[model samples]
Target: MTSLYDADGQALACTVIQAGPCVVTQLRTEEKDGYKAVQLAYGEKKEKNTTKPMLGHFKAAGTTPKRKVVEFKYFAREFELGKTLTIGDVFAEGDFVDVVGKVKGRGFQGVVKRHGFGGVGGQTHGQHNRARHPGSIGACSFPSRVFKGLRMAGRMGGNRVTIQNLRVLKIIPEQNLLVISGSVPGAKESFVIIEK
Candidate 1:
């Protein structure tokens, strides 16, 4: 999707994705499996990338190579085994969906960079090396142990994030595209799961 904003200067068209014609590999029911679910396989990968167990699984389904497989819980009752469920089947324009994906990894960041902590001494009395430092970490003999979740410097990002209730602006079934009205997590071409 384009990164350009709308007429009102809000983010516009940030999540235009070419979604699925994913194959239904497995069907789960409440009686036998103790829950309801439908497993979907999408994105064909090379034979080399597939493992022996995965290849056997695909072979049992009488289908081709797939890169990603995921399960959807509490699915509708109308689904069946070996059904080729496409993006056109579930989603439509004006429908609300949730996009779940992993965020970009930024390893080993500082407190000001990672946790949005205001650092010490943009201007201070006789401060030399205190810029961007997490100052005053403790009280004087009152609470000597630093409090938990105090926004210290650490690893950042690369976490699973879900953007909820994003409106589907358009659906191009021919192109397998889903144009959503807001931002989704992860980078371009990364695997993301969209659910109603």
Candidate 2:
């Protein structure tokens, strides 16, 4: 994330994202696939790590193996198989888009860290051990079992999150980078899908 000066000469915080240098690998037609969508593939992979079946799929598209393949449904422009798309082709400065990606994964966590929960007990009067612990789950006999959907200490993070309406701050076509307003989910090097 960085800050850039806008036309008003005021500093605007932004995050530069590598939007794409995606390739069209497959096309979905209403008559054949019952849906209209374009399948775009990105990120290169070694031939040794890819399966034989996938090798054939990429061969048919006249491209090498790619790691991430996503289907997008839009008709802004006609896409051709084996065609490469850059940030400039699909987006321009001032365009608003939605970014979808997986959030960073944290191993099993307790309620205080996972759910923004306050500590169960105070630090004084021998309450030191109980501060970080989750309090009693529920009643003793009324339900017998803990009700579902109860927020408690459990696995957390590593969920798919979507940030909507982020305005495009700038576009650097030479390097195929997009600068957008605000932060996005996921760890560094994680893949994300941008939608208009």
Candidate 3:
């Protein structure tokens, strides 16, 4: 993340993202695939690391092996197969976009850290080491079982999250970078889909 100044000298917090130099691998139409969408491939990978069927698919698309292939439904423009798309072609500076990505994984977390529970209030009233405990799971008799979708902690994070209405602060067409206002999901170097 970085800070940028506006024309009036006001600073804005932004996150620099490598937007993409994505390739149009295939197009889906309503008559054929029962929908209208475009499939784009991004990043590079060694041919040896790619599977045989994926190699054939790349060969059909007239491109090398790609690390990520994703389909975007309801894309407005028409694009020919194997055409490369850069950040300038898709998004501009000051455009509002939604960034979709996975959040960082936090494996096997407790309720205090996971659900933000203020465990057991304070250390008073003979509370011994039950501060971080999630008090009172379910009822004993009656229905006699813990209900579904309880907020008890298990695995945390690593979920698909979308940050909407993030303003595109700056666009560097030469490096294919987009400086977006506010934070986005996922760790550094993870793949994120930016949609307008």
Candidate 4:
């Protein structure tokens, strides 16, 4: 992520995304696949690590093995096999787009971090070890059981998240990079899907 300045001298926080050079690997039709979608492949991969069937798949597309292949439903127009798509092909400056990616995994987090809990008590004389613990979760006799869907300390993050309506700050066609206002999902170098 970086910062850009406008003519007014205000700094705009932005996220630079390495968009594409994506190859049109496959096509899905309503008659054959019972759906209409275009599958685009991006990022090169080693052939030795790729599976045999996937090797033939990339061979048919006349491209090398790609690490990421995403099927986009409802493309604006039809694209032929082996066609390459760059950042300039779809997006323009000042366009609003949505970015989808996974969030960073926080394995086995506590309630304080996971659910924004403020802890049980203060750091005064009587609050030694129970400050960070989850306060009473249930009644003693009425139901005598913890209710379902209660927010507790557990697995957190590592979920798919979409940042909506992000304004496009700039488009670097030469380098196939997209600059958008504000932060995006996932950790650095993670894959994200940009949609119009």
RMSD of each: 2.6, 1.4, 1.1, 1.1
Predicted candidate 2 versus true structure: per-residue lDDT over 1-196, tens digit per residue: 8999988999988888997799999999999999999999999999999999999999999999999999999666789999999989999999999999999989899988988888786788777578877798885888888889888888888999999999998999988899989888898888988999
Better of 1 and 4 by TM-score: 4
The candidate that achieves the highest lDDT relative to the unseen native structure = 4
Clashes of each: 0, 0, 0, 0
Per-residue error for 48 in candidate 1, Å, reads: 2.9
Extract clashing residue pairs from model 3.
none
lDDT of each: 0.84, 0.90, 0.93, 0.94
Number of clashing residue pairs, candidate 4? 0
Residue pairs clashing in model 4 are: none
Off by over 4 Å in 2: none
| Per-residue lDDT over 20-118 for candidate 1, one digit per residue giving the tens place of the 0 to 100 score | 888887777789999888888998888898999888888777678788899999775667666777778988788999999999989999989987878
Please write out the lDDT profile of model 3 over residues 44-123, one tens digit for every residue.
99999999999999898999999999999988789999999998899977799999999999999999999999897788
- Candidate 4 global CA lDDT score: 0.94
Instruction: Determine which window of 10 residues in candidate 3 has minimal summed lDDT.
Output: 138-147
> Judged by lDDT against the true structure, how good is candidate 2?
0.90
Clashes of 3: 0
Off by over 4 Å in 4: none
